[model samples]
Target chain A: MRAGLDIDMPPSNDPFYAGLGQAVRIGTELLAALIVGGGLGWAADTYLFASGPWGMVVGLIVGVTAGIRNVMRAAQNWSK
Target chain B: MEESPLHPFELHNYIPINLFGLDISINKAVIMMWVVVGLAAFLLVKAGRSRRMVPTKLQSLGELLVEFIRDIILDTMGKGGLKFFPFIATLFVFILFSNLLGLIPGTYTVTSQIIVTAVFALTVYAISIVMGFILHGVKFLGILVPPGTPGWLLPLMIPIELVSQLARPISLAVRLFANMTAGHTILGVLFGLAIGGGLLIGWLPFAFTIAMNGLEVGIAFIQAYIFTVLTCVYIGDAFHLHGADDHAH
Candidate 1:
């Protein structure tokens, strides 16, 4: 049973684990934002704007903005 | 016969049941989930019932798990986070157990399924959003607009913030799903090689399988820990929004 009792400390405090966590978080944040932004843009184009690909194009741009901002904020918090 | 690495993940109904036009079939992954839950519940209950001043091994082990979870809550969300110990602890234990159980040959890996992890992640994400609004009121929207941004940038920043916010649960879901799937798939391939190869050459892949199994065990625990900690961090962000007031000079 002792061998089964491998309770571990929280990895949040360990620099290496923290770094890995941050990387995962940042990657997800950026990709998710882009996907969401582009999705919204595409939706607008299809439903409201009725433009060919402009809506998706605008959405991609918005996604880029969100992704960059997310990365910056994450980096700032990490530095702190 | 060529064995596909993904064959292990294929679902087959053990006991098919339909009620109200819903296919609620008993499958390997579902059975594994119930087994993990039952085992965890039984252990915790037994340990609790037999508590003594001089601790038994089971009692001590239970205490250690509780303490570890408590520290995680405190570290991420502080004293305020203690309210969430039950939730965080359950998430940690369930995922940990599920991962470990999957390490056993012939058992299904539940977390390897994107749907399961997605549900967990999305629930946490939804609850965090609701909690944020409840705790901070309309001011929670202020999380989108960083402090000290010029008026012109507000238009640009808000949409970006919204997109990033939406990304949280997705990342959470994909991380667990990808990790579990990749690890198990590799193990499957290695085992296939070991079995298919003749006894003489089989020893080589067999040796690698042993090492990979050890790594998967460690990964199972690590992934569970990561999921729980990230959930805590999201909850903490909701409660505090630490940088919401930081002004750029």
Candidate 2:
């Protein structure tokens, strides 16, 4: 057990854990982007436009696009 | 009488206080935070007192922690990110101690509270935004619009970038809160089983409870490291948004 607790052991360097972290980061980023965009759109619809779901519909589309873009960017960054 | 797995998380006011229409009671969670702060301060002060020619054990331990935090910041943000060392170090140590301390029986876990982690996350998020504006002025908005983006695509790209940026704190807070809550809840359930079962069957769950405790200790450390590293990454993004374009291949 003492040998297993070697200070020199590079624990975080494991690719598996790194990949898992990246996956979680990417998943959450995508979800958050959609929520924020749609949320802003909903707020605008409610307060400014009174245009029913039009604002939210646009917001969701914009959000999805943004989410995809974020995922792509994250993937690129991670690969580097 | 059966106890709920979440009974440990219930807030019981040690000294109930109401002032200015606010329930500012001293609860277990609040007391635990104070205890963690005191312990960290005491340990750090003692470690700093011994400036020996050859490092003492306490000093070495302190230096090791400092070096670990420094390495995380440097790795994620590079040399320019060193300026955030103090803030990041404090955040790391506080959360680490809080998580570890919660593992002891009859102690509350501060990080398990969504509000606590959310506040920490939001504060980091605000600092990153403020620092970006201070360092880059109007140019900081460039973070919302990646370089080499087509002129027509700006409408779509901007919102995506904005949402992605906003997600950082939410993820940061939720990750810590969920991890701590889940771990503790599992441990609680297992212990309840061990006690509820007769002596013949109880030992099985008791053994599992011990094993789970060990895993929780590792998770406590990991969550702290993750929280600090993400903060560094966010700060790094703000300071070096332009550099990101250069590195994008």
Candidate 3:
């Protein structure tokens, strides 16, 4: 009810706050995307190489890539 | 697939012994809470004693913490809320210290324990309820009655609001406890896997361990913020200042 105005502002040009906002935004999106990517990758790996380590490999690769993309997006939006 | 690793309910790794016939259980969780209490007390006192026009590093740290809690109170309760600063600041400092203590190796991470979290949550509930009734008397019951409800719906709205209100403490405790416990458990399991799965499978789990550790660090701070913020929200409801809407009218 108080709204967002009550929250404290970070020091101007503070790298810590900038990084934190970037991390929070990016991390949330990345986690969701990873769930989707991991599921897809797991399904593909199951069919291609049944019960293989490649499933984890593929999932990790895609999840990391998507996570990085989210980080970049957050940086663009949150930067002062 | 895998075993539960550890039960959240069971007091595993906890040992009990008799101390002055008190039968104290020396668990990791209890120790961590003591550490949190000690650290908060130490830092705040040290900071208070060392105050200066040009602040020392410890004093500056204390000021920053005070400002953080002050903002939360001001934003939620407004200027009139300043009186509650001691309570709010203490809660924030205790939670933050407890959470950060969990990050230390071999520390019990008391917030990971449900009892500690429950106690803190109940404290907030007690404060808000007591304050509400004391300040507003019978009008405090009106908290459940929103401003514009039809008279017919008063019976229905009141009970639902009461249930929801009661659940606030449970949810607050669960949110902090679950997040901290789950995060720490995940880190534990990942590293356990790295150690158990041989060096061949080491890199993958190791990477996860590091990333999750970093995430846990963020979560440590976040859970503290969230717990404190919700306390402010509850406090706002208690006083029913104009900006606090859910309890309005």
Best by DockQ: 1
TM-score, chain B, each candidate: 0.94, 0.94, 0.88
For residues B82-131, write the lDDT of model 1, one tens digit per residue. Answer: 89888888899999899999999888889999999999999888878899
Arrange candidates by TM-score, descending. 1, 2, 3
lDDT string for model 3 (B114-228, tens) is 7788999899989989999999998888776767889998765554444445556766787678777788788878877887888788879989999988767766776787677
- lDDT for model 1 comes to 0.81
lDDT of 3: 0.68
TM-score of each: 0.87, 0.86, 0.70
Give the docking tier of candidate 1.
acceptable
Q: What DockQ does each candidate score versus the true complex, computed on alpha carbons? A: 0.39, 0.36, 0.03
Better of 1 and 3 by TM-score: 1
Q: In model 1, which regions exceed 4 Å deviation?
A: A1-29, A68-80, B244-249
Cα lDDT computed for each candidate against the true fold: 0.81, 0.81, 0.68
Name the weakest run of 10 consecutive residues (lDDT summed) in model 2 chain B. B240-249
Candidate 3 residues lying further than 4 Å off, grouped into runs, are: A1-80, B1-4, B7-23, B241-249
